[model samples]
Target chain A: MAKVAIVGSGFIGRAWAISFARAGHDVRMWDQSRAATGGARDYISGVLDDLASNDLLRGQTVDAVLDRITVVAELEEALAEAVHIQENTPENLDVKREVFSLIDALAGPQAVIASSTSALLPSKFTDHLEGRHRCLVVHPINPPYLIPAAEVVPAPWTSTETVERTSAFLVDAGHAPLVMQRELDGFIMNRLQGALLEEAFRLVADGYASVEDVDIGIRDGLALRWSFMGPFETIDLNAPGGVRDYVERYQTIYSNIFPQMLRRVDWAGEVMTTVEADRRKRLPKASLGDRQVWRDRRLMALAAHKKKSDREFGK
Target chain B: MAKVAIVGSGFIGRAWAISFARAGHDVRMWDQSRAATGGARDYISGVLDDLASNDLLRGQTVDAVLDRITVVAELEEALAEAVHIQENTPENLDVKREVFSLIDALAGPQAVIASSTSALLPSKFTDHLEGRHRCLVVHPINPPYLIPAAEVVPAPWTSTETVERTSAFLVDAGHAPLVMQRELDGFIMNRLQGALLEEAFRLVADGYASVEDVDIGIRDGLALRWSFMGPFETIDLNAPGGVRDYVERYQTIYSNIFPQMLRRVDWAGEVMTTVEADRRKRLPKASLGDRQVWRDRRLMALAAHKKKSDREFGK
Candidate 1:
């Protein structure tokens, strides 16, 4: 089992802690604020309980996994005896730089120092670190316990050995790690996401469809196949031949339409207001937490579906 | 039950005929070629048998449902008592225009004339038709029997009444129709698809990752949630507050990376060769048909999963 040190006991940090611990890792977490530490403890326990309730926790006992997680008050204590240090501090570059420097100083040379920065590139924080060779970005999708895909984004300066080792470590820990060859903002997930949002925003801004309808367009349409296969695989199966046939048939039209869709990102302020109003109409702010649970339940159901489908048909 | 006329007896046209037939529609299919009519008969029967095997055919008997579909040789005979005409001719503007003119002259005033054209704008085909008010693009995702998403793209001249009626008809026909307020090249599905492909191509072209890894990045990652909920709805449930909070947290980086990732599309020979090599290594051309069946079976399992999950959680 890997010994993981998760710094910053916030939502993401706590999530990472639970994910590792649930995967049978010896995890230690630390936070700057004592209050946040307590909250993290409560949150992690609650998350574990939820996992147990869903029968998703595979450990001998939830207590066994919970016992493996040690919440430390000191960052050095958390980093000590760890094979990998996952820094989940605030997204501020200065905070990241400071924390990364401390981690580099405290961690052993072989230890991988990974950051859970959703948007920030590793270079922004790891560039000045003395042990920068061991550092890379390991951005996880939200609710990492359920979603196991991690984007292992390495900076231009990050060593190849570090990237390879981190990828192997993550895979060993039951996470699917995708290595980014070059560091670009948003990584892979957010680039695809931004492209989608740009068009969704444009559609809403132009009064073509409501927020609800746009959501349906994805949940009920393209995203259904996308959930099982990526764009290339989707195209490959789309035509009789394969990707080449698909491209031959559709690429000309898609290429023709690409320019018009590439518009300025207007964020659709007015449309957002309308959407907010509609969202409020459908689901009140007071019930947002309940709705969030509904969303998680749905995600769990989706995850369960993927597991079942993959097993049955090798999807 | 809706009385629908399916024009043309190609693969897509046959699929549409089965869809309507399965939905308990009095479906009359018209084809100029006798060979095409015979092909449709065999295809429809095979699809019904498959549906029966899967326990998806809701009708009393597969034969009864098949009995409802009549193969008529003349357009006038097909549109004689039809309430809605679904034109599924080859994707050519001239052919569409010719069919639209013929259908408009023959069909009654109340009959909603819809084209299953994936790429053509309704305006190009319906501008000269007398029943242009009732004419619009009702483009379906392939194999609509399994994936029931139709983009109801209306031309600027298409009546709001027509759009609403078409939407209602599609919903009644057990299809999810997303109404596009105006015509855009590629419509909604393909545009979203194009955006994804652009990124996938760029990723492969730039040598950031392997084709298989890129496919895993989506299938195992973003598309998981996307299949059940859209990016906006996913983010809405992601953070504490919802989309606004999500944007505040991740937008800075997404905005930062958007420009850098927006590379020009290079559909050059070498890029295709590289992608093909990568894909062929994973999935050979000889086994494409077998893989397609695998894809369909997976889709079936996925559909079953969605049904169960949605029902259990009321999502």
Candidate 2:
């Protein structure tokens, strides 16, 4: 087990703590807010207990895993015995730079420093760090305890050793790591999400379908196949000649619609108003908290299902 | 049980036979090739046995379900008793026109004539039919026995009664029906798929990442959440204020990338060559058949997992 430091005690940081501790890592977590760090251990304990109840816990026991995580009040204390420091402060470059500088100075030179910045590129803050070569982005999907996808993005200056080590570590922790060969804005997930949202926005805005109906198209139709197989693998198995045959048959029509799909639809105008109204009807503001609980339960159930499935049918 | 006629004995038609028969429908199937219809019953029995073994069989027993299906040599005999005629001929407009005309003439006026045309709109062939009001598209994802999402598309001439009945029938058959408010090219599934494919193509074309890496990004990342909740519901549950808040935060960024995303990337050129080459290396042409079998098995396992999940979680 690696000695891992989690330098934030908020939602994502707490989640990382659970993931690392459950993976048997000796984890230390620190937040700028003393109260945040103080409460994080209890919060994570509850999460681990929930995961155990669902048969989704990764460790031997909840207490055994919780025993591995230490909630520290000071950043230096968190970094003292760490081989890896996961920086998960606010998504501000200024905050990130300051945090990395302190982490670089306090931690051992061999220690890997990673950030959980979803939007900002690592170069924006890590370029000036003495240990910049070890800094990269390990952006997790929200509620990483349930979803295991970690987008490991490397800055140009980040060493190949760092990328390989981070990916190896993530895989060891049972997280699926998608390491970027080159830096691109939004990485892959958000870019794909952006593309899908654009068309979903257009479909609703153009009055072709309701937002609810558009979503049904995905959850019921495309997502069932997509949940296990990727898009390319999907098309690869779609045709007799595999991916090449699929492209040959559908390329003309997709290209034809490319021009029309390019047309701008205002995401913030009538579309937002109309969709928001519909969403409000479906889920009232008063029920958001209850709905969030329901969503988490469903996610846990899905995670458990996928785990069993992967075991039965090799991942 | 409703009398259902499956008007083809190809892969999709045979699969539909299994779906309807297993759903306790008195199913009659016809194919232009007598040879095609002759071998269908044995093939269906094999599939039924597989479903039974997986605990995914819908009816009382394999023999009981198989007893409900009849492989008819003549189209008239098949349509004579069909309350619902599911046309699954070749995806040619000409073939669809001819089949629908025959089905319209032979079937009772109250009988619903639904085409399983994945690409062609219902209007393309149903416009000139005497019973055009009763004709619509019930486009299922391939091998609909496993994936139950059926796009219930209607031509302008199609009546509300037709849409409602088709959706009800699909629900009874254990398929999720996505009823469109109005018809559009490719409908929702293909449109969303096209949008996703376009972005995936561009990512490869631009060298942002490899095709394998892109596929990994999806199966590992976005697909996990998407399998259960859709994009809209996901965003809804994501923010504190729900969908509106999510739009407020991310709309500007998505809008900014709209133009860049709009740029057409040729799907048939060097990109396809590169992706197809990589895909072939991963699974050779000789192994494609075995891989497809593996994919089908995985799909079955996923379907079983989803069925239990939905019962527990309530989709």
Candidate 3:
């Protein structure tokens, strides 16, 4: 069994701890402030209870998984014996660079250092480190215990072995990694997401559709298929002949709309007011925390449903 | 309680017949060729059996729902007393215009005429009709009986009353209509879909990621929440404060990437080979039909799961 170290004990770090520990790894969590790591363990304890109730702890008891994660007093102690070191400090590039430098120097030479930064590329932070070859980005959708897709992005200077090792490690920890050929700005998920968001914002701003209507298009429509299949597979099955046939038949429709879609809609511009108003009307700001709990519960139920469905229907 | 006329008996028309009849509407299906209409019943019969087996026929027997849909010999007979007329003729502009002209002249003034054309705009076909104000587009993703979301797009000439009635009628028929204010080229679903597809194609074309990896990003990652909540609700709940807070914190990242996303990769170009090869490797061309069946079954199971989850979790 390999040891996993979490350098920053925020939400992302705590989430990584749950996934690593639940996967039967020994996890060590540490943060700059001692209170943060302590709070992370407490947060994880409550989450483990929720996960256990939802049958998501992989047949292990909550205490068993919780017992596998230890909050360490120092960053060096956390990284000392770890084969994999996950850096989840603040999103700022300078903060990440500084933290990665310390993790690189203190962690074992065999350790693969990974960042959970969704926004910053790996090169910006790790290029200055002495052991930069071992560093890559293992960005996750928040709360990795539930969401499994992570992006394994390597810097230009980073070794291919690091990418393979990180990808394999994520898979072992129950993640589906989108291993990149090289680094790009938004990676895969965000680019796809950003593409959709730009159109959604434009749809509302252009007075063609309402915020609710656009939501209905996805929530009730396109997303249903996307939950189980990707866009490529979706189009593959859409046409009789396959993906090529699908493009041949439908590419023109998208090509015509491509010019209109090129115009970027500023998410924080005038449309934000309408979007915020609609969201606030539907879900009052006061109950955001309660709704967050509800969202997590829904995700758990979906994950459980998917587990059963995958077994019955063939994964 | 109402008579609904389906002016074509293709797959979409048959699917619409099942949904409308299951909701207790007396559905009359007619097509230019009698054999096609005959085949539609045969197809719907098989689908109804599947729906019944999955407990998806809305607590009604397959025979009960099938009995409400009748194949009419003539268009005039079907349109005579119908409250709503759904035209599903060939998608060619000339064919739609000619068929719609005939439908307009024969149908009663009270009947709301809706086209199932996903390609052409409502105005393109309905402009010259005497009853143009009563006409609009009611586009559905195929097999609308299972997928409840449909785009109710209105032409410039379409009245507010027409939009309201169509939206209400769809809701009554167990559909979530994206009630669009004005008709655009791709409508809501396709526009959003097109945006994502463009980025997906670009990713493959630019050699940044593989087809399988991109698919995993959605099938496993982003689409989980999208199946229940939408983009607006997703970001609203993502941040601490709300949608505006999410925008304030994260919009810059998207805005920065938006420029890179503006360049459209020709989907029919080199990328088609890679995408098609990837898809074909997963499922050969011979198994496309079987995969389609699997997709439909998956959709049925997901729909059933969503129904229960929505009730238990509070929609």
Top TM-score hit: 3
> Compared with the true structure, what per-residue lDDT tens digits does model 2 show for residues A1-315?
889999988999999988988888999998888988877878888988889988876637889999999988778888887888899999787998998888888998778999998888888888888888999999998788788788888888999999999999988887888888777778878888888888888888887778877777787778877887789989998889898888888776666666668777777787888888888898899998987887788778778877877787665
| Candidate 2 segments exceeding 4 Å error | none
User: Candidate 1 at B86: error in angstroms?
Assistant: 1.0
Which window of ten consecutive residues has the lowest lDDT sum in model 1 chain B?
Answer: B260-269
- The worst-scoring run of ten residues by lDDT in candidate 1 chain A lies at A262-271
A55 in model 2: Cα distance from truth in Å?
A: 3.7
CAPRI rating of model 1? medium
Off by over 4 Å in 3: none
How does residue B1 of candidate 2 score in lDDT? 91
TM-score of each: 0.94, 0.96, 0.98
lDDT of 1 by residue, A50-166 (tens): 777666676456788899899888888888879888888888889999988888998877689999998788888888878887888999887788887789998888999989998
- Evaluated at residue B267, the lDDT of candidate 3 is 87
Error of 1 at B221 (Å): 1.6
In angstroms, the error of model 3 at A123 is 0.6
- Each candidate: chain B TM-score: 0.96, 0.97, 0.98
